[model samples]
Target: MTLKLSLSLSISLVLVVLFSIDTARAGYMEVTLLGTGTPKPSIDRFGPSTLIEANGRYFIFDSGRGVSIRLQQAGVALSKIENIFLTHLHSDHISGLSDLWLTSWIWQRQHPLQLTGPVGTLALSQHLELAHQADFSYRTKNTSLNSNFFPILAKEIVSEGIIYQHNGIKITAFLVNHYPVEPAYGYRIDSGEQSIVISGDTSFSENLIKHAKGADLLIHEVAAANSELLAGNPRLQKVISYHTTPKQAGKIFTATEPKAAVFNHVLLFGISERAVLEATRESFNGDVRMGHDLMKIGVGNELIFY
Candidate 1:
């Protein structure tokens, strides 16, 4: 009887351990900073792009320059990604769209690439189709690729609300102030008990704070320049006017109180990453990390960055 009881206790402990591991795995939402640079070309940092994996599905936030290469570096199969959400119609954010769309189709994407963005998204997709007409025809006529997958299905977000929900993953689009770029947006993604917020090129938006509250991870943009350069250059001043300064981002981070805060789309004209972090620490006391290309973060019961 003593031996039997010991055996039963061992089996029970093993079952509990397996259950705990499964629960932790199920609650995780994986995020990868595919590219962490702005319009300025950098060998270390590519253009702005992010990949979010939840419920075994892949979603890309922006298709910036070198996004395909970044995705390859992240070991994400191009053919597996079907949905892309654009923050705005900025050239740097959409320049790699053609490459991603065309290459994914060639790589055996089974469906039309689903693109969700602001008002001009459909028009952009239409123009892209027209521009790539010859290539599409050549591939379909000569290769085994299906012509049906040549077109891109784009949905333009007209208002702020829950834009996508599938397999327990929910994505919400909220308006952000990136004026005079009207209808710009930030996105909040929720899966199980884990949440992530991406602040898409905004300048201290209260709406972003509202949406980002208590999130597992908050990825935001930060821009900084040398004080003398900023004072002398009207162009730099105008550029900074549309973007969130590190200090301003710190305020937002403090208000949102996320489990982890990261800076992406880093645009430091003459300052260093340490300077940005120092400025942000002025207002926020929490841990802040400077996002690097291909950095992976997992949101679960505990925030994990790798």
Candidate 2:
């Protein structure tokens, strides 16, 4: 299926209608952009991090670029973050971790930090601890930090299995498409009637669809502008070989029938002239659009109101 402009416009109109229906939902299920860029390093996009908060407990997905400060933008402090889920070991996603660790320690949280991710997580935790040796040493003397700095639980996930099950919310990690960066995964998060699947930096894969199926939202990474790569950036010609085109993403959503799709890691949403996006949208069949920083999503399928 080709992504169609008419479909995109229709989806936009639908969102406007939905937002008009209930203004309260507009406030619930806060999904904030901690960072929205990729390796390309656009000033508009930070990196690739997302924050999802509901009820009382906070669940943080990938902690990509500027995540520490991004949390401030989301209005969530370090102690509020109960669980941190990493999709892979890519630097952008995990780079902000060291800052998070230090802040959590400085704040001296009462609850233990729940750190879970694919292979190398334990090793990464080790590196974080070592990296923060100076900070930890200083904070432990503050008495408050003494009790909270080192109290953490690390759940290492090498393959697909149950990673988190607690507090009326259960999250499962499934292998995804970003190969060569082995053991990459997408997460299935279910909280009562609210369910969302997050694709952490991946190309189109049936395996991802399996995890994303029947969910309220699918947040997937979009690739570089296809036309530009094919024409302008000769350097990216080699890079584009590994990712998913918007057309392909639309097809995946068409098959998965996700209630709605919010494209992240978007290369050209508000910055470029949008010629490439028009071509990409021509391939997606259902309601499809791109996102920017602070684009919040309310719960429910296809109820994507910007």
Candidate 3:
């Protein structure tokens, strides 16, 4: 081969390699908080839901109230989502599944939705399908809906470990202490370049601390401070027992040492935002912020908030 031709080919190969590196760098791992509230409904906050976008793929952490609406607001198409990971079967956490399922199918989403979570997830999916049997039957007969697409793929998480792996994306589910719920979970998503941890409604969990250590971002559930008003309330105590306070969450953040920590599923019934922030800052000196509905955060070399 001529030296001139060899030189030209080498230059072209170098350009291609540079272009690939630039493209990968331009891609971002974005996390959008679709709902940041709990069971107690609020006008501003919906329910506990989050969307993680990595490598052009989207994964939903939980399908909470108004998730479909918030997802649209975030510029995400319902058809693009194929799987949903539920921490537990709490009414508030899975409330928006019906809306997401029905709306996507109506809009001609051809892929079967995959729901992954603890043991009872399959049962939950079956029950929802039964409840919508009449609608499914009518839609199948009257419309061009494919009956094959009606069945949802339910993956029941039987043990603690890596539950999902596709391409370079790996999702690990670890047991959390949302006791009486048996097998509640917190998930860690590692997409080669970025890592995110979502604490799905748990108390101070050592397992979470182990998994979340040095994550790019950690989104943990936090409850309102136990103040004088809630001091004697048995119901309030029960709620607090099953969840983590901002102070406790802060300590966990300190231990885990993430690049940034977000307090989500905020149960601020009476306490002010100032109180929550102060409590979290008392222990954790890292970059910490409270989560709000529709808040967008990107994890890359540095944390970006949108």
Top candidate on lDDT is 1
| Steric clashes per prediction | 0, 9, 0
- Sort by TM-score, top down from the best: 1, 3, 2
Model 2 residue 298 CA deviation in Å: 1.7
Clashing pairs in 3: none
Candidate 2 lDDT tens digits, 1-306: 346988998899999889765543432455666677776566667778888876567888887777777777766778777788998888988777777766766675667677898888888888777766776777667565555447556778977966777665678899887868888888888766567788887777899887777877778777755464467766565455456667678777877787777778765423352553565567666666677777777664335464
Each prediction's TM-score versus the true structure: 0.95, 0.82, 0.93
Q: In candidate 1, what residue range of length 10 has the lowest lDDT sum?
A: 20-29
Candidate 3 local lDDT, 1-306, one digit each (tens): 699999999999999999877655554589999999998888688888999988788899999999999998988999888889999999999999999988988878879999999999999999999999999999998999878778889999999999989867899999999987879999999886678999999999999999999899999998875478688788888888889988898999999999999888988758897889898999989999988899999888778998
Tens-place lDDT digits, model 1, residues 1-306: 999999999999999999988877775889999899999988899989999999789999988999999999999989999899999999989988999999999999998899999999999999999999999989998999988888999999989999999888899999999999999999999998889999988888999999999998999999999999999999999899899999999999999999889999999988999999999999999989999999999899999899
Would you list the clashing residue pairs of candidate 1?
none
Q: Whole-model lDDT for model 3 versus the true structure?
A: 0.89
* Clashing residue pairs in candidate 2 (N, C-alpha, C atoms within 3 angstroms): 2-282, 2-283, 2-284, 3-281, 3-282, 3-283, 3-284, 4-281, 259-302
By TM-score, how accurate is candidate 2? 0.82
Note the Cα lDDT for every prediction shown.
Answer: 0.93, 0.73, 0.89
List candidate 3 segments past 4 Å from native: 1-27
Looking at model 3, which ten-residue stretch has the lowest summed lDDT?
19-28
